[model samples]
Target chain A: MLLVLAVGPSGPSSRSEGVLVRDNNRSHNVRVTDQVQSSKVPVTVLTGFLGSGKTTLLNRILNEEHGMRIAVIENEFGEIGIDDALVIDAQEEIFEMNNGCICCTVRGDLIRILGNLMSRRDRFDRIVIETTGLADPAPVAQTFFVDERVRDELDLDAIVTLVDARHIVWHLDDERPEEVENEAIEQLAFADRIVLNKTDLVSADELEHVVQRIRSINALAEILPATYADVDLVEILDVGAFDLGRVLETDPMFLEDLDHQHDQSVTSVGLEIAGEVDEGRLNRWMSWLLANQGVDIFRMKGILAMEGVSDRVVFQGVHMLLDVETDRPWGAGEERINRLVFIGRNLDREALREQFSSCLVEAV
Target chain B: MSGLHVARIACRAEPLAELGDRIASVAWASDGSALAAGSLSGQVVISDPTDGAVIELAAHELGALTVAWSPDRRLASGGQDGIVRIVDRTGEALAEHKGSGWCESLAWAPGGGGCLGAAVGAQVILWHDGGQLETHDAPSTVASVAWSVDGRRLGAAAYGGILWFERGRAAPVSAFEWKGSLLALSVSPSGKLVAVGTQEGSVRVHRLWTGDDLEMSGYTGRITELAWNSSGDVLSVGDADSVTSWTFRGRGPAGSRPDVLGGHGGRVLSLACAPSGRGAERIITGCADGRLRLYSGTDRSAPLAEIDVGAAVASLAWSPTGDSVAFGDAEGRLWLAEVAP
Candidate 1:
C-alpha cells in the first residue's frame, strides 16, 4: 500500500513508529473513507485564551440534548467548582481540578482521570477536555497519542480553539513572555477549528482584521465566526480533525506547495502529482523523509494515486505517530491525482517536493 | 473442602454510587489475620475473619486506589485524593504525605525490607522509616508499581515502558520500552524476572539480569491482572473470559505457551493466585457477569466452586497463607472464602 502521511508532534527529526492496523478476513471491499478508528471513543479538546468563552461553550454542550454522553474534564487555575447546581441538573459527569497547567505539568492528572473513566466505560460515550486559557494544547493532545491505554480506547478528535474576537489581536502581536510560553500562537497554530467567539463583541471591521491576523498565523484551519460559542455540535463532534480527511475533502488545491506564512520558524509545504506512485519506492522515500525530517514536519497528510489500488490511500501523522489506511475507492469519472500537505517549522519545500516527485513511477 | 461467606454490609446501591462504598482495592494483612477493603468513597473496612469484628474508617474524602499492610502489620493506603496515609491498629493516621495527583498504586518491598513504594501520577514516591519520602520521576503516568522479591529494585509501569529504580536511588537504573500502558505487574518469587500486563492485551516478561523481553499475546481483551506461582515457575494472566498461565522455566517465557482456564461470558475483572506458601496452586477469577470461580492448576477445565453475587467483581486477593481469599464487587460488597484440605 502506498502511504501518504505527515510526521507530527515535533519538527523534522522524530520518527513515528506507531501503527493503526486492522487485519480481518473480509472478502467484499466496502470501505469507509474517514477511517477514524471506529472502535475507540473520540476526545475533542477545547482551548483558547482566558475569557474566550470556553466555559460558556462547555455549559452549552452540557445542557443541550445532543443525545451523546460527554464527560467534561476541566483544568482551572482556582477553585471554581463549575456551577454545581447547573452541572448537577444537567446530569453530566464533570471532573474539575486545579493544576499547574494542562500543557505538560498536569498532563499526568488528565491521563489518570481518563484512565479511571476508561475502566467504567459504560458511563460515557465521548470526552471533552477544556484546557486552562493559559494552557498549551500540544501536550494535552500528545497524551492521547502517547498513553498506550488511552490510544487503544480513545481517539484525539480535534482541537477546537475559541478566540475572543474583541481582544485577540493584542495577544497576537504582543511579544511572547518567556516564562508563560506564548500560548496565543500555539492556540492558533494547533487548532483544527478556530471559533471567532463573541463575534458580536467586536465590530465587523474589527472581526475582519482579527480573522485576517489569524489566517496569517494558521493558513489551514477552518475559521468559524460564532456568537457566544454557538456552533452546531455536528461541526465539532467526530470531525476527525487529527485524521486530515475533512481538510482533504474541502481543499482541492491541497498539493499547491504554498509559500510559508506563519511564525518565522513555522512554515507549510504542499505538493501535487498526476502520475501513479510505486508503493515500494514511495515507502522508501517516506521512511527517509520521516527519519531525517520527522520532528520538523509536525502534521503531514496526503491522498495517493498508486499503481495497484482502486481505493484512495489516507495517511496522516503527528510527530512519530503515523497512520495509513485505504479510504473510499476512486469515484467514477474522478481524477486520480495525488495530493500532500505538510505543516511544520523550517520546511525545505524545494527539496521535499523534488524528493516526493521522484517516487512517481517512470513511464515505459 | 472450603466454605465462603459474604458480609451483610448495608451499602445502598444507587446505580453507580454505592452509598460511598464502591470497593476499589482489597488486600489481606501480611500477617494473614485481617482483610482490608478500600472504597472509592475513601472508606477502609478491616474485618477479622476469626469473629465478625469489623472497623470502618473514613480515611479519605474521595476514593482509595490501593491498600497494603507493611511487614509490621500496619495498614497503609493511597487514594484519589493524592494522599498516602499510614494507619495504626486504632485506625489513627501515623503519617500522611500529600502528592499532587491521584495516588494510584502502592507496594511494599519484600524480604522484610520495610520500604513502601507508591506511584502517584508521573512520580514514584518511596517511603522509608521515620516518615521520609523519596520521589523519583516516572517516564509517564505510572499504572502499577512492584518491588523485586529481594527488595533490590522497584519497577513502575507506565505508557512508554517499565522503569526500574535501584533501592534508595532517585533515578531509574534501567527501563524496558514496551510502548503501552502497563496495567498490572508481578515479580517472580526469586526476583529474577517480572511480568507485566498491558492494556493492549499482552503479558510481557522482563528478565532482571539481561533486560531480555518476552511477549505473550493473543488474548481477547486487555490483560488486567498478573500473578506468579509460589516458586515463580509459572505466570498467570487474565483477559476478557479466560485466565492463562505461561511457564517461566528454562529460557523464561520465550518459547513457552499458555494453558487456558476458561472463564465467565464477560470480562474477567480480577485474578488472584493462591500463595504457594501452603502447597496450593489455584487461581481465582472474578468476571463482569458477577461470577467468581477458582481453578486448580491440575484441573484446567473445571472450577473448584462457582459463586454468584449479582454484581461485577472489582478486585480480589489471596491471603498470604493461601487458606482464604477475599474479593470486592462493584456494589461495595466483600466476600471471604476459606478453604481446607
Candidate 2:
C-alpha cells in the first residue's frame, strides 16, 4: 500500500531564490543578495533509523520521470559497507558522501566534496544526501549553514525522515549514551516531514498509537503514512521546510488532547501563553538558554507576541544556533496568543516554563 | 621603510586538464624532474615542465589537502576523504593508507631517507612506498606532520603540543607543549629546530635538545606558513599579511624580535622554503589575493621578485636547485618561474 500524505510548503516566500546555474555556461554567475544564497545549489537531506524505508523512498524518487536531474549522496557505515551491495541504479547520478561523521571530524571533507560538486553543476539539477542508518540528521543539515563555501553554493531544502511504523517504539525505546541520546528519536525530532512507512506491518489500532506517539514527540512537522516508502513527488521536492518565517506552524488546539505520559525522558513541551514577552528579555533568555543547554535540546520553534511590537517574532533553533525573524503582522482585534514547542531529552519542563513566563508582560 | 619591495618574474602558466578546480596543494619531485599538484576537486596530476606532458589521475574523488614527493620521485598525497595514497609518476598506486578521518597533512623525510609521514584523524602514520613503518597517536586531530632531515624522527603537531616520534618507537620520544592549536609545522634542514604555526596568529620555535621554546606574536590571524632559511639561523613565517623572519642564531629564536618582510592584499596562503640542501636558502610565499613573492637573505628582508598568477595562490613548491619554483592557484592553474641569480 502506498499512502501519500500532502504536506504543503511551509514558507514559499522565505525560500531564497537559490542562485541558479543558468545554463550550459559552466561559469559561476555571482548575484548581489543574501551573501549565502547568491550562487548556491539546492540540497535535500533524507534521514531515518535503520529499516525505515529511506532507501525505498530514494529509489522511488530517482525512478520517477520528474524531469529534474538529481544527484544522490549515499553514506554507509565504513566497517560493514553493506550499502555498496544494496546500491540502486538510476538514470540520474549517485556518489558517496564524506566518510566520517559530517559534523565532527569529516567536516572539512564535506566542504571539499560539496565545493567540488557545485563546480560541476552541468550534471545534476539538485543534490539529495541519504545519511547512514543510525545517523543524526542535525549535523548533515548544519553543514550548509556552517560552511561559508557550502552555504554560498548550496540551499538547504529540508530534512525528510522516514519512520518504521512496525518498530518505531522498539527503536525509540533503545537506551542511549549520556551525551548522545537515541538516534531514532533524533531523526524524528529533527525532520521537517515524517513519513510513517511500513504501516501495513501494524494493525489499525497500532498504527493509530504510533501516529499519536510521533505527534507527542514532534507536532510541528507534517506526518504522512505510507507503505513501502511510496509517496508523491510533489510532497518531497522544492518544499521549503527550513524557512524560519513559517516554522512556528503549530495549531492553537493541536495540543488540547496531549496528556503525554511515557517511561521515556524524551518528549515535546508545548506552551500557549497570553500577553507579550519583552523583546530584550526574550533575546537574553533564549541566548542564554541555547548557549547553556542547546545540546540537550534538539529542536525548538515558537511564535511570540513581543511587548510593543506589532509583528510576531518567529524563532527556531538547532543545537547552539538560533534563527530569529519577524513574520507577518497581527490583524485587527486578533487574539495575540504566543505558542512554543520544544522537543528534547530530559528537559526540566517547570524550569523552562518558569523562565519563559518571566519574559511575559503583564496585562492591564 | 615599507619593509616591502615589488618585483616581477618571467613566469609561465601551464594549466591542468580542467580549470576552476582550485589547486589545494603542490609538490615537486626530489630531483626536480616532476611536479605533482592536487586540486580541491580531488584530481592529482604529475607534470613534466621540460616537455609539458601531464599525467592526470583521480587521486581522491573528494579532494586532497596535502601532497609531497619522496626522494625516489614517488608522490604521496593526503586527501579530504582520509585516504593517503603513494603513487608513481605514471599514476600507479604504489601504496595506500586509510585512516578513520580525513588525511589533512603529509610530509616526507628529507635527504634519501625515503620516509613518508601523514596525519589522518588523531593518529600519524610514518610509512614508505611499502607498508606502515611506525604509528603515533595524538590527543587531538593532527594539523601538520614532518620528519627530521635524516628521517630519524617524526613530529606531529596538534592542539596541546607537537609530539615527536623516533624511528621504530611505539611511544613518542618527546613533546613540545603549547596551549594552542598548531596549524603548520616546519622542521629545519639540520633537524635542530621544530617550528610551528598556531591557530592564533603566532609562531613557536622549539629547540629539540634544550626543551626551550619561543613564541613570536604580532601577526593578525592564524599562521598558515612557516619556513627555515638555508643556515637554519633564520625562520620566516606568514600570517595572512606580512611575512616575518626571526633570528634563530644564539638562544634559538627565544625572546627575539622578528624582521617583517612583505605584505599582500590577501593573506599568505602557502609557504615553501628552498628544498635544495646545497644552495643559498630563499623563502617563497603565495597570497590569497593571487600574488606570489620571493624574498632573499638570512632574515628574508630583501624582496627578490613576485608575480600575480591571477588567482588566489593555494600552494607553492621550490625545486631542488633553488633555481626554479612551481605554484598552483585556486583557479586550478600551475605556474613555474625561473629565478636567475
Question: Per-candidate TM vs. native?
Answer: 0.70, 0.72
Give the per-residue lDDT digits (tens) of candidate 1, residues A1-364. Answer: 1111121111211223212122211101111224544677788888998788888888888778776667777755221223221111111111111111121122545666676666552446778888776775666766665454676678788889989998898877778555444677767777778888889988888988898777655666789889988988778778887664544664737335344544455555677778887776676667666656765565667788777788777776654345566677889999988887776666766777778778878732
Q: Where does model 1 sit among the CAPRI classes?
A: incorrect
Between which residue pairs do clashes occur in model 2? A40-A153, A41-A153, B240-B267, B240-B268
> What does DockQ give for each predicted structure?
0.13, 0.05
* Cα lDDT tens digits for candidate 2, A1-364: 1111121111111323221111212111111133232434667788887688887888787767776666676655331112211221111111112122222222333443465455441435677778765666666756555444565557777788888999998887787776666878888888878888998899999999998888877767788889998877677766766565556654735654566644356677777888888655665666567657776677777788877778776666666545556667887888898888787766665677788888787621
Model 2: residue A143 alpha-carbon error in angstroms: 5.6
TM-score (chain B) of candidate 2: 0.90
* C-alpha lDDT (0 to 100) for residue A62 of candidate 2: 72
> What value does the lDDT take at residue A247 in candidate 2?
63
Q: Per-residue alpha-carbon lDDT of model 2 for B1-341, expressed as tens digits?
A: 01133223457644533434777788888778899888866788888978878888666754667788887888888875678888887879888877766687888877776778889877899885447566677777787898876777788987778888876888898888765567788888767877888654567777765667666664545565887876667777776466767776775344445676654666677877675454466678888777887766544444576776777777888877877778887777777777643
**TM-score, cand. 1:** 0.70
Candidate 1 Cα deviation (angstroms), residue A251: 3.5
